[model samples]
Target: MSNPKPRIALIGECMIELQQRADGSLLQSFGGDTLNTAVYLSRALGDSGAVDYVTALGDDSFSDAMCERWAEENIGLQRVQRLPGRLPGLYCIQTDAAGERRFLYWRNEAAVRECFTTPAAGPILAALPDYDVLYFSGVTLAVLGEQGRGKLLETLVEARRRGAQVVFDNNFRPRLWASIEAARVAYRSVLPYVELALLTVEDEQALFGHADSEAVFAAYAQLGTPEVVLKRGAEACLIRCDGQSYEVPAVRVEHVVDTTAAGDSFSAAYLASRLLGGSPVEAAEAGHRLASRVIQVPGALIPKD
Candidate 1:
């Protein structure tokens, strides 16, 4: 008989999103780095695997709506914590004529900040290692703060020790960090435990000061990360998996409406394909195809009719 469906848990924050239209109207929604990945991954995997989101939220209406949306997408929220009297974070997206996007955040007091540090988070942390895969991003690290991060690192160590593969996305946002060195130290502390690393070329350069792609791969090689993918917008993505390298070009799109969630969507498809036993090259192609379509849409999540 075939193996049982893989159980994966994604840890991060989900925010109330505002997408600014050309007419300056704001389209309200919910999105976040790992949450976007969770939605897309659930859509991609269907009944092939189980996807759970691990985070903290408020008991407010917005949080209620977010959970409703996740349920519609078939993402498991068993690990979600509803902290009394707290609130979810918020962000706004502004797009340029070139379809590139910028963000303004109002997430300092979000309940996810207490995700791993709070007493209520203990049970969730203890249960994380039971999953087949544990996924998170740099944004997850930034929001977790020092104490929460310490708790998270301990959980990751225990999770990996129990045979759970750890997946990481270096979705670096400089503004979220107190300083460059602090970010570096946090990342270094977790890098050795990662089994797979999904990285963007620009974010890698900005965060690690790597001059080029070769340097980025060389650094990850030192960390003994077995699988590494470098995502470059509009350019071919590079993959170094199982001691081999491959370059897969992105699908060309003539008219890009909005570039929101491009990387997050790509990461989701890539991880999904890999979990489904696709080769690295095939996974890269799958990621590019999904990301190309996402950039042509207006929001982080496309309608799932």
Candidate 2:
């Protein structure tokens, strides 16, 4: 992006997080892959850029607290839609000794499933093309469903035509899709409009059956994506940009408390550094530093300090 501090809107769901402690107690919090990135992106940009979250919620106290927290984090609330009878989704996080996490979801009927289908979405959709950047994830595609996704795809088409950069992260979850074929269709449909793709090697392998980073890069290249970052956990991230490839090493960490938001934090710092006019290598380094710190913490969101 040309602007040092660009206007960015992240589209996805934020759920009530129930993190299971070692003592067998549940710790309440708010977290989602895209929401984690939004909070970190807002912090990384400070007052220089704009970060907005686009989603739907209900009239429940949980939803109220979510908006309150997002406001506190400096994420814009203008695009939030409120549905009277529905409620936000919930999820539980379980981490093993290695800090690798597993998720249990209760969100088949989340309010965010209707985020782009509401009456309020018309204005939000209209305003989207004006932003400097539009960001979303594979999970965002999964939850938004058919109708909501249609609106989002249409907005992305317009946004691209108006010169807005569209960013996508491949944070895939198999359980969220009806089949692997369905996920492939969804991903392929939106990829043509994407300018930068923040992809995890595992996700790309699982989603498209790519055997290695070369295959992943070749596939995205064939799809005509300008830039792609292939993140391999604990290994160096490979960046393919401007027809050049660079390998930026990940930070070494002896301990990982929870791997919940490692990739989210990485993407946040990467985007922030890019907006601040850093090169691909510099941005990837920033991502590694932030992700190294995030993995040392226990949750999706670490302390701002």
lDDT of each: 0.93, 0.94
lDDT of 1 at 153: 96
**Model 1, residue 87: displacement in angstroms?**
0.6
The parts of candidate 2 lying over 4 Å away from their true place are: none
TM-score of 2: 0.99
Candidate 1, lDDT over the whole model: 0.93
What candidate 1 gets wrong by more than 4 Å, as runs, is 1-3
Per-residue lDDT over 161-261 for candidate 2, one digit per residue giving the tens place of the 0 to 100 score = 99999999999999999999999998889999998999988898899899999999999899889889988778999999979999999999998889889
Relative to the true structure, candidate 1 reaches a TM of: 0.98
Model 2 residue 202 lDDT?
89
**Residue 85 lDDT in model 2?**
88
Sliding window of 10 residues with minimal summed lDDT for model 1: 1-10
- Alpha-carbon deviation at 88 in model 2, angstroms: 0.8
TM-score of each: 0.98, 0.99
